[model samples]
Target: MGHHRAHVSQGHERGGGQTHEEHSGSHGHGGHDGHRGHDGHAEVFRRLFWVSLVLAVPVVALSPMFADLLGYTVPRFPGASWVPPVLGSVVYAYGGRPFLTGAVQEARARKPGMMLLVALAITVAFAASWATTLGLTATLDFWWELALLVVIMLLGHWLEMRALGAASGALDALAALLPDTAERLTDEGSEQVPLDALRADDVVLVRAGGRVPADGVVVDGSAHVDESMISGESRPLRRAAGDRVVGGTVATDSTLRVRVTAVGSDTALAGIQKLVADAQASGSRAQALADRAAAFLFWFALVAGVLTFGVWAALGDMPDAVERTVTVLVIACPHALGLAIPLVIAISTERAARAGVLVKSRLALERMRTVDTVLFDKTGTLTSGRLTLVGRAAVAGLDDDELLALAAAVEADSEHPVARAVVAAHAGDTPAATDFRSLPGRGVRAVVGGREVHVGGPALLAELGLEVPSELGEAVTHGQQNAASVLHVVRDGAVVGVLAVADAVRPESRAAVDALHAHGVRVAMVTGDAQHVAQAVAHELGIDEVFAEVLPADKDAKVVELRERGRRVAMAGDGVNDAPALTRADVGIAIGAGTDVAIESAGVVLASDDPRGVVSVIVLSKASYRKMWQNLVWAAGYNLIAVPLAAGVLAWAGFVLSPAVGAVMMSASTVVVALNAQLLRRVDLDPGTVTGRAADSPSR
Candidate 1:
């Protein structure tokens, strides 16, 4: 991990992240148009590998030197010797084209890498083998080695190339989430049309089991929208008139006519896709370092090959010296080293997307593993964003129904969350009233049933100098302790009833907090709610810290203060007022994924409102880093040992590595690295699995 650590250290100095331009320029991996080029390389190398391997079988078997080394005999035939020379040449020209051309590009750029090393080894072997077949030099007959080298290098690259395209697979999956066409509502009736033909304000008829054509508000009808592709919620959300629905989400149970507010790039699907593509293009800091390391390996192997030839020739064996040099150069494939980090980064991002965690920045993925504390914005993050009527109480003269109806009538004119909850809770007719007036923090004052009635929190009770009677005091205290928004109802300045409006905690919140805690992360809650309320919710969720009554403008100060205390903080919020704080934190985790604020304010978006995505990000970071380290150590170790052995360092012990053995080791190392990186996809990041038993929220 020495060189791997160097990569991370340099990344830290550069803000623990890198740009897409730097990744491409530094890698100079022939083609750098993100994964598009990688996919091309994968297909090319896969074909090259299989063809070269087939041709190598004969070239290897027909070689006298190979027969002698392996104690096997080939049938004496006139054309048998020609088989090696002819097939080997074809293998070099066809299979070696990619590496040879790639080496030329690197040479022109004055930056060499694995391609140059592989090219040099095969060129030397091809030249020497032909010469020996014509009796030009002794002991330079290595057609078998040349053929195998090309085949093995091709195989190594083929495997690495496939792994590098993992990000592309995720991108394609995202694109495939949308339907090919949509039903548009027109004056003549609904007609099928392409998404591109649709415009803003175009009404789309989404039938049961069809995806929403665009981001819009439901104008008519109701349905359960499954936004799992965008929001990561497995369950379909109920959608009704005036409710917003994102494009690409499914209308699961009923039909809905939606008024399109956004199309094309403005859709949430487009936004999420762009964020993902941007992150994938950047690559990981370690991948950039590996590219540099590959360049270094090329120079290292070249210098060592020259030294090996010089020493051996000085001992009076020019032909064997050239072969030994060829062995050393080819032994340094560098494929494993080249793949060590990038493949891990690619697979991690892919897995993150599947878990509803969109990693919009490599630095966020890199730093999440280091986070020791998480600051959560309370209201819309831990709790459902909307207020629901939870409990009600009444005075001796009125029944519960009458009290609720009176309160609803008074609150009908107000649009406050508390008022909405009260109006939504009332099942019977609410009496009409006029003389509606706003009291700001104190609550609303309106004429209900021709009597002046008031509704508000405890502040309104204090302003009116009214104490809660013993009949409703118990419920009021209970509501206050649970952080429920208690609204006091008054008639003609006298207390009449009370209602409890609560933002019920999401069922996923407890599991998320528990999982973070299990990972040794300290959970803290920050909100504009009062101390008592914040503390009550914090206690219920088992959070370790609580910062209550925090104004939206001061949220960032809390993040800055925590970071100044030597704690690595990750701020997860609703991405509204918490934008500044999110930008200030070491890692910004915007809880709501598809929201513009979430996408713009944070480095990481939870595409779903589930808090467990925080854990997923951390888990993926650590897992990816572990794979990077594993691959680096294996590749570095293989090069270290194989280079010396191939250079005949162990010849005195009769344990020297032949060129064929070196080629085998190179491909094996690459296979090992790719398999290890692929293992990341096996990581279970589902929020439901976080704590094993998340308590369910009772339906209202």
Candidate 2:
């Protein structure tokens, strides 16, 4: 029930109310607004970096340096000790403004993040130094430290933004593949229009070697389209009239006239972008815990800083108490803690997206790291979902090739699925017959090579009282067990042979299934087919479990049952029937070839419709989680050590950590966490294997 509600909330039923903003080719900053925010933050940090660098010089110059260099005792101005504090104030306000604003926003929202931590620390150091400069006894100075902290933090943020830009090469590649302008057919020949303005049903002429402008159907010409972006097949696909082509795929040869079917957000390329965006915004329960911790740190730092100051003032060490209070405030904000999880998650999400695996939520991604069981739907998930001829038997005189030829000719005029199977099987080998006659739900008769031919199921053959051979009967029986349709070929009034075709698994299935097991995840098969057929598929794929003849609602129950057993379940499917189960599972993975369900239910969408994509998402999730943990540990470790030093725990050992020094340490720790998260871009997450049986080719 919780899962159902969550899916309902996240489902796009609110309507596409998408207001189009003129986005001039923005890269992956999650979305346009996010990109703007990032850019604004970067600009602020850049300004701060330079200003703080300038302040650091003055800060050093104001410190005993000029006095020593000139060998002259300079008269201290009224409250001359305040010079460092005033200069440090400039650095903190100018360089640290963004952090302060961000910290305040987080505070208002009751969630303190990196900004909150950094702002609190720097603000405290500035306030304390100002008081000390005004003749209020303060034990230590933090002028240099505060200036250095601002500089280091600004440098770190710039580098982090650059890393984000660099890791988004996939978006760049995708953008490069699409032509900015398309030639739309108009009354006066062709008009050049922005690609997005090409509406549905628009006729566009794509020249030879041009990329398809939108998801469209070939209207008047044929071409070989390189659909590597959508299908992941390195080879180009042969397209004829009435065939659908996705936008961004290159047309290798032949000029094609295509009628645009889906444009704007409706195109396949746009769908991929949406999936990538959705994946990046996903989150889990564990992430909530991390947010809670950062929020707690904010309050803790505020209260501890106040208490430290009160205690020292009561004990007559006013200056020392004020300094300790500043230390507490500076060390308390978990700037590193704020960045620990999000940075790694961001990098991992982008990394996975580029590989064509869109991660929907953090929970889904995290579960991928430790999933114990994976369930796959048979059609369109493990298998190609298309029926094709895989077996044929010849009569007493006819050979196997001749049987296929006769079957293909007799079924040439039929529109039934079985007839189409025969046609697809012998597509290029035989010329279709003339004078074809189709009998609805019964058979098709056509004149092939000046001879009459008839093709249909056993019933059609029985109508003519044809004798069935023992070999043919045995083959039909075996085929029934495997859920294959048997088509009989009849020529000159006699049954010549039989063709057996079934929906087969992809050729990549076997290895893909084994790879999942090797990763410690058990594979299961769930299908709406009969038990025997399901068993046949399971046995072929070496699946650990099978659930057959399942109703759509029952699939949801099965997922609940698996989750009840303390297993993290990942459901992979591309059918509407699988949507409920996909939504119910711990992780819902939809194949890209399955556009509707992929958008509706799954948290992870494999752009290439490869079962191997499941393995890729899991690998990336694990790598991302590991990086997050590593960064968190290091960030927390720095705080654990720095907090004690800042409080003068080692003062007796001649190791007093000054306010400036504490601020610098805190800033360094944040950069370390951010940089560590950036390493997730290098994680190798190949789906490695794609398991399938030989009966049919996988979906395009």
Candidate 3:
């Protein structure tokens, strides 16, 4: 299983009959506020867009230039001449307010962007149109162009906000998983109470098909729990008594009485939400590059607009100069460039979160694309970390069952992991043992049915100076050669039998290594286990490199050695000893079931204990980076071509762009970038099907 971080929220009583409030940690991205707050901004832009569109119709119809271009004459009316200027003024003030305010914010920060470019273009158009209306100069009227530009810009912003809202819907979906009320088990039966009223140790009844009110363990009954929302595992897992059930999961088929272990912000769902928010807020190298490019473009447009106006005015008339300059500024707004990277980052992070791949570092995610090697820690990461009986041998008269039972009876009261494995493997009821004694760093001793029995490893055998009989000696040698820990069982100071124990390899580890090879990434193993043990596992998984018998503190040095060979390495581990190596690697992936120290040091955390999640990380990294480049190339290329045309470069061929038409092209470019980022959602990330082709490849 992957590393899982457990958190518990503090409980408090409600005052004045009010329901207890659920408090979540403050996310850097402002949690739901970052998305919900945009609702008002989107609504304002939407309302202004429609209203501006309505007011622009008369302005376009009454403008002399528009009528002349269409080969028509304006109909004379009592108030027709005043309609264009009055409505154009209203559109500029009302519809363009957001852009005006945004420009001010950017200016105050000394980093002008798309908003400033837009504000400059419209302000010039507004001033020039009123200049013509008051007879200040005989220039072409710009009232119609100003009105249309505002409406188009407003429409574009509204669509952008809506797309952001859709991407952030993941947070809302997570929040909705918790039920408002819970059925608390009480003395008189079950009583309904608010979800926030649930405290740790409170037994709650989770009826069939009901959401688990909080993170807890099953106390009574059994059920299949659908944890897909929390763990991204599609199949419902059978959860019996003492099984942990996270809040927001559903008990599908049977009712369960669960003892609440955590509530509110302490739940796993809350942590996942916080991770998503943090990833979105984190800055990346690519984003910084995009920001720099946008800042440059802002100054470029400002200077180019000035140069275009000065050159045209010296060579021609002021009217043509104003029109060309306005077009230049409008077409070079950098709207697409500014949004290119941020949009891709937002969508990709949300997509990764939904797949149970939590990205703690944006830079590590970016680095995953170049990884050449994947180094996995052996214990608990690639293996189950639980000892299993692999081989057994018995003396002449003692059968295998008789030998195992004797060992189990002696170890029944010991708290060592190996002792538990022995007891678990025994089939029949264990004989009663009394006066149990634990030998520190050795094994255990107990009186089983009035016979003094002792179970220990090689140390115990040497201390007692009792040699293993030839019949069991061969088995002990074979077990040692195969990297299994053999325990010598002694009854009444005489060696009786031997049992071999080894940590079992997980079924997913082989597939995980094979998948990495399929992606052309070399796999390596690092472990503090003995050379024979580590090598045996490496050979089984087809690992290319092995670093065995390394101390926990020296694991990071192994990662450094790989890097010194010019290898871009990714490390996957699940222990406190793995923390240094995890941090030293190019990309550190912590198993969801790993320790907190390992998790904190990792750049990515896999929610499932399955090793296939490593493959998912690589796939997502490649896909997300591809989208980022596609957007950058498009945004930069659009400006390269559009900026010159808007400056009247093709006027000699009778093709000059008006400010209104320039605004349309700019908005279209922004829409294209947004749509391209959304395509990342279609990439297949399901761990089950993710490595199909890898499994069929020849072993390296």
TM-score of 1: 0.87
Would you list the clashing residue pairs of candidate 1? 593-607
**Better candidate number, 2 or 3, judged by TM-score:** 3
Best of the candidates, TM-score: 1
Ranking by lDDT: 1, 3, 2
Write model 3 residue lDDT over 354-420, tens digit each, in one string: 7777777788899998999999988777776666787899888888998899999888886556776
Better of 1 and 3 by lDDT: 1
Distance (Å) between predicted and true CA of 620, model 1? Answer: 0.7
- How high is each candidate's TM-score? 0.87, 0.80, 0.81
Off by over 4 Å in 1: 1-78, 137-145, 155-169, 173-177, 184-194, 201-203, 218-224, 231-244, 316-319, 595-598, 694-700
Residue 2 displacement in candidate 3 (angstroms): 14
Model 2: lDDT equals 0.67
| Residues 169-200 of candidate 2: C-alpha lDDT, one tens digit per residue | 46546756789999999888999899878988
Model 1, position 612: C-alpha lDDT score: 75
Candidate 1 whole-model C-alpha lDDT, 0 to 1: 0.76
